[model samples]
Target: MNTSKQRPVRVAIIGLGWWGQKMVSILKSCGTELEIVCAVEPNPAAGDFCANNGLTLAASYDAALARADVDAVILATPHSLHPEQIDRGAAARKHIFCEKPLALTKADAERAVRLCREAGLVLGMGHERRFEPPIVDILQKASGGHLGRILQIEANFSHDKFMTLNKSNWRLDPQEAPVAGMTATGIHLTDLSVKLLGAAYDVRVSCETLASDFRQGDTFSAHVRFKGGGTAYVSATLVTPFVSRFAVFGTKGWIDVRDKAHVEAPAGWIITRASVGSLIEISEVGPAEPVRENLVAFARAVRDGRPYEISGEDLVNNIALLEAIIRSAASGEVVAVG
Candidate 1:
């Protein structure tokens, strides 16, 4: 491991939207470990603000990408644009931490991954939920077999219309947020379920747009059949009050993860296991830190030290499943994802 704790990472933040602000804030507030190389947002207001705050301001992402001063980029752009952004960033040989729904198509995702691999760059999707403390614990236990051959997993995410990715933004344009709202969330939920279930096998999905004003998919449900006959259920909605819940059901016991804004707490997971006489509650918060830890992991990988605990392969698979869900929804039938 590169114990060079003094080494700082030069990073640029693209897009200054809602989530983009979080990324920008996390990078800027990371003390000395994260150096703000540039701020690239089409919004002049945002760029001017970042520049006023001592960050190099770029008019566009391409300008930042062309700069050799930056070693990495955090892209919290919209979903449909992820593929092109990732590919272009990889070509520039910049380590990447991008938002979920890697691409509108699996082909684009595969291309982005291949390009990054060839460029010898780290390409991490912003599947931030995966790094949530409770979710991490649940996955660790599931992978360790402590969940006893996980039989089923459930994922839920609900947000009000105002919180929808495309609610008031350009994301409402199908071309900009393809696969509709599915990419906005199905990407995260399905990917999460697969991680806990071990593999994304067969998937049957259905979707509907409940709101007349909503641009794309409003709510979706998917039934995923994993290897070893395990089943996983996934769902996302834009009409409900905010509720985030994740659970894994195994032959021996089950694990549940729930959260709202921060989702899982940094302290640890509020884990529950059932027994004959009583229900056991285990609070296991592993290593304090929330979203920042994921950024640190990315920083370590960018330094070519130890690879981030999560690999690029896991990200690619998630995109694959994401593509299949869209296909299933589009075709009104089940779609298989490798």
Candidate 2:
């Protein structure tokens, strides 16, 4: 979508962890729209990753910001650091593409978004599920009135990475990942629900530790009431095997997109119509590469001055929903989303 004839964007990648490295690898084959020219990582092991990948290792984010060639920054750092990193990147007048949740709190998210708006810089978040093909298909049908008055939606995304961890990590901290699985998995479905069902006004949640060696819990679920009269239920567990599922029920029909637990597996879907006799099978190979597509979308937005799909209000609303979910879980009462 970045139809500009300008040269490719030279980006500085901060954080060289697993997700950060994944982004670097994707950018290698991510075409001519963007390029990773430098990286910042304090870990000595990341030095070899940078060297092997022909990237300059900067001592700190300030060093990366000082480079004139570095047109933007891709933040793959922890969730808590996003607000400050985005603030610094925006201050430097560099386009920013930060990984999701944006910020754990509504105020932080709003401030980060406001800073980018005032700086006239493109701000993109890593809600990559927006680029998934099955999601696109469902959205198209809903928009076309084919789904016919979407009544309710349900989704569940879970994985066992928390149970698999033996050593202490940031994810185990309540400050970093409060609400446990909600921050890790439920947030993705929450973003999707926000995009599809509009802003949620009331939230009721149940979060408990079923099995975990860490201080945080392993299971979480939330029921949300949208301002538009739609309802949604989302659940996740940190001790379960990998699984991702999304379903929507409407007056005319219903659709279920079941994604394989493994990241490498292609997602499939099934749709059932009230008038039809049997469930319709929709099989498709080549699930949309969400991470790659999200990067490209950000590149296009930066290069062409195009608007990113998720609006500023959506960012704030999503965080409000997250905060409300946590509050409800703690209070055992339905919390009103601001």
Candidate 3:
């Protein structure tokens, strides 16, 4: 690892929406290795936020990229804009940390990964659940064979956070957020499932509007078959109360985790494990700053030459799985993942 940490990595944060503001708060709280040089938001309302936070407001993304002081950019923009913005950022020779669901399609995701790779810039992802304490422990146990031959996985990440958004919101637009809650909540579950179970071979999904006014849909459930012979069932609902749970079953035993609150709130986590012949055990994991940890890791990759935890393969595969889910939901048939 490169030990030259003489200066903090300066980054320009793009977008100042709810998640964007949350990221700004997280960085302000614990981002010692990172410096928020500027905030790029076209929305005039965000000007007050920048003023109060003492951050310079860039007139546009182009303006931010033109600055020599900005070493990286944190993209918290709309889903459809990711691919184009990534292309532009790479051309500007700026490292990028994009939010979830890198792109709406596999081809776009592949191009984004390729551009960042060719530019020799770090590509960071916003799947901060991997940095959560209980999640990290669960992955370690599964990888260490403590779970013994994984058979199946089940996960649900649901919330009503977007139910209040206007029907015209980009998040509710079919072009930007197809297949309902998949982009907002279910994608995180798929990312975790891919890590635990391996590459998904195919998927069958169902989506329905249910209670939300959004035209695309509000609820979705998917069944994924992994190439490694394991299967997973994942679901998310946009009209439900906060519910984040994950479970893995193996030939030897099973493990379950329940988060007391959302990743942003960080209440705590309850984990339970049971072996075939042993008693079930339950434990509690205290609240942690996973979002901050993820950004810090990204800054380290940019400044200290450390490898970011999320890999290029993981980024592309997750997007491929998402594409399959969207297709399956649309056709009401099983869709194969690349």
Candidate 4:
């Protein structure tokens, strides 16, 4: 509603890891509305990246927060530090856009969301899969009754990139990435499922590590029972070949979506009706710059008072289900979401 298209949003990128660099590239290459004014990274190696991109390398997060030019902060830091970083960013009256999981625990996520709301700041989570064309169609049809009553959903996001990660990598640490692949890839499915079928009330998980060299577990599968009477399954693996698939099953028909492990390539989807024929296929070949769209959305919220799509309650509920999955895997029992 704030038609001020000329307004610029100054943003700071935290963390200088591979994923952080990816965000930087998207913002620079896609010509989005966001401007990367500064970056908070402790690694001296990232100084050149900052210098080349015209971003000031802040000595610390506090230093970045103190800057007047920064209107929002995109946090790509470790999961352990998300809650504290979000709290600090909100306290500084800056909009916060954090990568998925928000926080590892429900308590931390609730605190982060609460502080952001209390400070009247936008809290955006980086679950960009919702922006995918196929995913958009699924959500649209499901809401429009084309999919009838949704009964089940299945999603699996797996890649072999983790196989090369070293022990020092935080993702290889259990404390940082729990329930095997849940934190890395499966969380997207959980977020998407929650979007389709309210919050999950319980979770049953079976995860294990078959690779002896892998620091963290390599395989994970979780079954979620939603409060809205829908069931979902999410699976992820580190040793398998790259594959990404999502499907929604309904009483009348089903929609299946598949994509490459990388985002640069196009994705395809299929809609099936028992009486209509075999299947209808749709291929999306254009660039799917979800990260850019996500950043632009955040900027719109900051500049024009437009609400960020991900709400505080949704953020808290996402982490709640994640915690339940982790717990279920550990105890080998179905855990009730808190």
Q: Give the 10-residue window scoring lowest on summed lDDT in candidate 3.
A: 1-10
lDDT (10s digit) by residue, model 3, range 48-103: 99999999999899999999888999999999899999999999999999999899
Top lDDT hit: 3
- Give the number of the best model, judged by TM-score: 3
Residue 125 error, candidate 2, Å: 0.9
Error of 1 at 313 (Å): 2.6
TM-score for candidate 1, please give it: 0.88
lDDT of each: 0.71, 0.82, 0.90, 0.82
**Ranking of candidates on TM-score, top first:** 3, 4, 2, 1
Model 4 off-target regions past 4 Å?
A: 1-5, 30-32, 264-285
lDDT of 4 by residue, 110-195 (tens): 89988988888889888888777778778898889888899999889988887777778998888998877889889889988888
Candidate 1 regions with alpha-carbon error over 4 angstroms: 1-5, 161-168, 178-181, 260-270, 275-289
Q: Over the stretch 176-249, how does candidate 2's per-residue lDDT look in tens digits?
A: 88886888778889998887788898999888887775566778889999999999999998888888888888
Least accurate 10 contiguous residues by lDDT in model 2: 267-276
